[model samples]
Target: MITKDIQVNCSIVERFNSLDSSGRLAHAYLFVGPAYIGKTETALSIAKMFCCEEKPTAGQLFCGQCSSCKKADSSCHPDINFINSDFGEQIKIEQIRELLAQVRLRPFMAKKKIFIIKNVENITLEGSNALLKTLEEPVGDSLLILTTSVPEKNLDTIRSRCQIVRFLSETKQDLAEHIRTHYKEDEITSQYFAYFAEGCFGKARLLQEKKWFEKKNEIIDGFLFKGWNDDSIKKVLEDKEQVKEVLDVLLSCIRDCMLIKHGIGQNSLINVDRKEDLKGFADRFSFDELVAINGEIIKTCKLLSENLNLKIPISVIKEML
Candidate 1:
């Protein structure tokens, strides 16, 4: 029997299985969706179909007990390759050249050679174009799986060569339940972090981490009650990623405050953290004034990322209130 616990997208799974049944699977596939939506997992599942020794008896897929499946699980499959980079650095032309050179060779143990590339967007322009050529004329039994959080960041030429399978963002309830179950958090916190996560497990994991909770609460309190003071926001600003997240949290909270001013319920608020904090602001600022502050957040977040004077925006945002 074919069984999967991880909410297998039935339609997508069907299409993939049908392709294999007809012996007409595409050479390249683009799995596009928000980060942490299991795009990588789905690609790995499909790769198993190409390499698994024990074929699925019920459906079109690899049996979990196969040696190839074990190899994939161990991340040491000779015929399967996975690569990603932090920035747009790893997918350069040099890497593409070497990978393309290898793709031409026959598979060692499996009938198919599979290359799974993560962060397709980070593949530089020259590298993407180079990849486009191989994608254009794929080897007879080779499959390439490209996964990206931002497929739009990749070159159109590379995108045009692949069949795109889109993953839907999980619901807050579903995602939160999953996190709470696996992460072992209190119910209220699980719900809180779920809403705060905005439907991304990667973000949820970061938000739910105990190490960050105290710091995050302190930051939220800093914005909610404290004067828009230099000493307050400056603490988080010390860390680039923390600065970005705190700013983003502020922007989102202010948005909630605006909605509340316009008669949106607290129940409807998106940021699960510090709703009372947003309420505190909504009580102090008018809807229009809150909106103006929200606009400042947009501008400030941009400037901060561009390495602009952070203190200036912080002062400006405070002064706007």
Candidate 2:
């Protein structure tokens, strides 16, 4: 789809149009935002607009019917390439080398060749330096779009060469509406999905598909009152991905509970799906206890992200409870 079709803040769209229209668009562009919040889609739209055969009418973006747009959107165009690791993973040295080798060649159909590198933060130290030369002296016809959840990891020099675009996500209500438009979810369940997504539409869709809110609430409730037992942890370990998602949602829940205890009001709770139970537990647990629990959850999540032993963290959390 074209850039105009995307539902994002107007400031971002306006900035892109201004740059592209004035012919001042930078060769290396950095998209700063959280994960699963449409960064990839926005980058793809930019690639399509750059590759469009005809300049689109004002306010209208790349025409999807055009050959260039179709090829780019479908990711079949030789000129439009996505540089990431195997299995849509990281930005590795090999991927960067292959991208560098490809960009040296001429465009297949479009006037310019575009590279969309997802998660620029994942670019290795070696890969970053390798891409540095390309970013320093662009072929004038080649464009690089780098998307990252955390832009701090990118080298300062690399960031200076690029035009940074910040993508703000929709509010809870907005995400809920998008969910309702695309799915058959009820109002309550849809709101829960939005709350769990933490204002990320793409994440909202995935959690909606998995009905993760249901699992999240169940897990939190079990942890508070019933507490986690061997059989319960065993069942959770059965699905590692869902277990990870559940832990993330659980951490958010504890954070909300902490806020509520500090008198932030019920509406401010991210765990709105079970505000009463969460508040009750928050009241039962002292402020220090709640804070410590939240810290452990966050620490555990961080360890998991680094590919640590999951059992050890879970065991620590169990003991803390």
Candidate 3:
């Protein structure tokens, strides 16, 4: 069932199902949440509900036995279109123009044509401007579903045209329980993932699948002990996605060091497992050095978001360290 595919956002799911059941669905819906928080999965589930030939009678997921449901579940539905840009790339104006042409066509099988665009924030300025008309006035049998991790980055004109649905992050307890039940993990392992993920199920799953937790710890240790060099910086910043992850982990480790320096409780630290190492690093850096490093990290993150180079910002952080 589609609901089984969603590990969180139960309330939002129930409300959407009710709306669909009553035939009062919105023409457009903006699903907003943090990265790896099931926004895409929930959006796909809603799409299934809309496409299902035998819709759920109660406030539940679509009937899996129906032909339409099976097709949608398998991602082979002709009427449903999934649009997303390549990693670290914007959705170009050409893509939006293509989408405009596709939306004019009638649904081949289902009653409505569904378009699911993921990471709408990555839409270029020209692309967003081109998309505004359809968002404002859609065909009766067409539905648009947009999902984004950064809502603030989207145009206000576009956001004002659609209904917004916020997906709240789960509590540590709830997240841990979900991981324990769904992933078939023991309590301790589940708790670790839940804490490190900070309430995002997809992130927790990724961390487990990629073993990033240990890898990130190793990176932090290398940065603190061996210190940053040209070769190390080059290797870490090689990939765009890896650069983001590395920067995030580096920032967290520095934050943990700051907490230790301030005599803050260990519970507030993001890298709880590396508390002792963080403390040792904290002693080496003066308060001023830590502050400078933190400021550089903030700047680096902003630069990265704007598709700028990371070498300089990263090098500055290294100099401060």
Highest TM-score against the true fold, candidate: 1
Cα TM-score per model: 0.85, 0.79, 0.79
For residues 1-321, write the lDDT of model 2, one tens digit per residue.
234443344455456657878998778888888888877777777677667888777666666678888887678988888965432366779889999998898887877888989888778889999998998898757889888887877789789878888877678898888788777677767777887777887777777677676777777767666887788887776766756876877687778778987889765666666777777767777889878887888888887778777777777777766
**Decreasing TM-score order of the candidates:** 1, 3, 2
Q: What is the lDDT of candidate 3?
A: 0.81
List candidate 1 stretches off by more than 4 Å. Answer: 1-14, 57-60, 180-187, 210-214, 226-232, 271-277, 319-321
**lDDT, each prediction:** 0.76, 0.76, 0.81
What RMSD does model 3 have? 3.6
Per-residue lDDT for 1-321 in model 1, tens only? 243535345456567768977987889999888876667767777777678887478754677787888898788999888876654456778878888887998998888888988888887778887888789997867889898888768888888999988888878899878877878887667776777677777667766564555665666667666654677667756777776877777776787888877887666666555676667678988777887888888988998879876877877776766
lDDT, residue 24, candidate 2: 84
Clash count, candidate 3: 0
Give one digit per residue, the lDDT tens place, for model 3 in 213-304: 67876778677677766897799787777778777888888888888888999767777777787888899989878888888888898998
**Candidate 1: residue 267 lDDT (0-100):** 61
